[model samples]
Target chain A: MKFGVLRFPGSCDDVDALLAARRVGDAELLWHGERDLKGADAIVVPGGFSYGDYLRAGSIARFSPVMESVIAFAGDGGLVLGICNGFQVLCEAKLLPGALLPNSNLRFTFRQVELEVVQEQTAFTCACGLDGPSPVVLSIPAKHSWGRYYADEQTLADMEGRGQVLLRYAPGHNFNGSSNDIAGVSNERGNVFGLMPHPEHAVDELTGSKDGLCIFASMCLAVEAARV
Target chain B: MKARVLIRPKAGILDPQGEAVQRALPALGFEGVANVHVGRMVELTVEDASQIEPMCQKLLANPLVEDYEIVLDT
Candidate 1:
């Protein structure tokens, strides 16, 4: 499975995401201005201060030429994963259900967090068989100020009913004060996924936890299955 | 025509920045404050006033997290 990691002008974690994707399969960098996805099986929108976080996080980057392609790619049931600021971009593009607001404490924060896989059937978390009967929890790092997940009560209910929610902070680990402890979510169709946490940063066991690979490995299997 | 777009946090939405500002006001001796909410204003001159509303919906604000008002040169 080949993964394409997008790089906007101020994308600080683009390379890290690319390196993490390479752990599972072939991966390369795709510029924000890219018109074509270069035949990547899956797309990863990496985290960063894209467009210098001007106006709002991911608002400007959402208009990038590459996103047009990403939108079309996602519309076709292709696998797409957005991490950190990329999740913000997906929200701005209306690819995801809710918008991420500022952290409740109004402070930028980053730390290792415990996230539970709320939905195991989605393409993003199907490989998360982490020695659990059900409801697998993984240790990952989450960062940024605008990571508070928010949706109206009705929308939240609809998403919950549809199993669109993919991950949630485990109990007290709701660091950003996300709605319903939601740390990650997928679109209604389940092909597009977004997470406020940095799974890429957690790929190396030397750094602390290798739990992120399960998510990436999940995507690899998704792409592989699609090609079959 | 000159128009201003008033974009405010939607009612029932959490505004941490506004809450922080409100909390700090009492310490500075500015009491009797209530509903201290902050918002953004966008100024523009357009040929047609009708287009301004569309602009606000498309770019000036995020509908899910914010509410925007259009005023003619307010």
Candidate 2:
């Protein structure tokens, strides 16, 4: 499988994401202004300040030429993973549900956080390697300012019922005041996933933890599953 | 035509910036202040009045988390 990592002008983590994807498969960087996805099996929207965070984080980036293609690609059941600012972009583009609000404390926060795999059946997390008890937890680095996830009670309940809620902050690890401790969510189809944590930054244990590799590994299975 | 769009966090949605400002006011010895909310306003000129709503719905604001009101200048 080949992965395509997107690079907006202000994208600081594109290189890191590109390297992380390379660990799993061949990967290349796709420009935000370009219309081609370069025949990638999966698309990774890496985290960083895109379009200077103008209007709102991810708001302007949603309208980029590449995102238009991405929307169509996702609509066709292609695999897409959005991290941090990429998550915000997905929300703005309406490819994912809910909105990422400012942190309750109104400060930028970056630290190690614990996330519970909520929906392991989804394509993005099917190979989490969770063989034990319920609420499987993974330790990964999370870095963001506007990471607070908000969805109304009705919407949250619906998402939960449909297994659209993919990841939750374990115990007291809701660092951004996200509603219901939501760390990540997926589209109803489960093919597109978005999370605020920097999984790309967690691929190596020398820095922090290797638990994030579970997610990317799962994507490998997802691609195989889609083929069959 | 000239228009102003006001965007605010919908009622019941948490406004972190507003809360921080509200907390700072009390520290400055000001009391009796309540329900302080912070919002943004965008001023633009359009060729037609009909363009205001579409602009707000499409780009000026995010309908999911914010409520927008349009005011037209006479």
Candidate 3:
């Protein structure tokens, strides 16, 4: 599978995302201003201080020309993943269900977190063999001031009813004060995924953990399964 | 018309910068700072008055996190 990682002006994780995607298969870095989607099978919007976090995290970067293409790509049933600041961009673009607000403490948090895979059938986590209702713990890094996840009560209920809660903060930790401990979620169709944590940072064993590989591998397997 | 757009943090959301400013005000010889919520204002030069809503929706502010209004000059 070929992955295209977007690099907006202030994107800091573009290289790490590119390297992670390459580990799973072929990948390329696509500039934010480029209107071309480049025939990529899957797209990953990596984390960083896009547009210097001006106005709000991800708000400025969402207007980049590449995001228009990413929106269309996600709408067309292509697999799209947004991580950290990328998650904020997705929310700002209205591609995801909820918005990311400032942490209740209003401080930037940078730490390793344990997240539970609440849903495994989505394109991003299906390869983990997490077939049961139980949650699987995955270690990842989160770094953001506005990482709190929020949605209206009705929308939150709808997401829970549809099993759209892809990941949640493990017990005893509510990093960044996300609503209902939600750490990640996918679109209604389950194709577009967004999370505040950095999975690409955990993809290699040498980097301390290889658990994040499941998400990258799952996307590849999911696309291949669809083609079969 | 001269209008000011008020951008304040939505309710239930924390405003650390505002909090820090409020804390520093007493030391700066300012008294009676009841609630110090900081915000920004952008002065716009518009050729058409009908462009307000779209400009606010598209670029001026994020409706999810902020609220804005316009006042016409008397």
Which candidate has the top score in DockQ?
A: 2
Candidate 3, position A100, lDDT: 87
Native-to-model Cα distance after best TM-score fit, residue B47 in candidate 3, in Å: 1.8
* Model 1 lDDT tens row, A128-189: 88455676889999889999999999999999999998999998899888999999999999
* Local distance difference test scores for all models: 0.90, 0.90, 0.85
Docking class of 1: high
Query: Candidate 3 chain A — worst ten consecutive residues by lDDT sum?
Result: A127-136
lDDT by residue for model 3 (A172-204), tens: 667677889999998899999999988899988
Going through the candidates in order, their DockQ values are: 0.83, 0.87, 0.42
Model 1: how far residue A107 lies from native, Å = 0.5
TM-scores vs. true structure, each candidate: 0.96, 0.96, 0.90
The runs of at least 3 residues in candidate 2 whose Cα sits more than 4 Å from the true structure, single-residue gaps closed, are A130-134
Model 2: docking quality category: high
Q: Per-residue lDDT tens digits of candidate 2, residues A1-228?
A: 888999998999999888888887889999999999999999999899999999999999999999999999999999999999999999999999999999887889888999999888877787775565666788899888899999889999999999899999988889799999999999998889999998889889898787787788788888977789
What TM-score does candidate 1 get on C-alpha atoms? 0.96
Per-residue lDDT tens digits of candidate 3, residues B1-74? 55556677666555666888888999999998966776677676667767877777877777776777775554
The runs of at least 3 residues in candidate 1 whose Cα sits more than 4 Å from the true structure, single-residue gaps closed, are A130-133
Estimate, for each residue in B1-74, the C-alpha lDDT of model 2 and write its tens digit.
Answer: 88899999998999988888888998999998989889899999888989889888888899999999999998
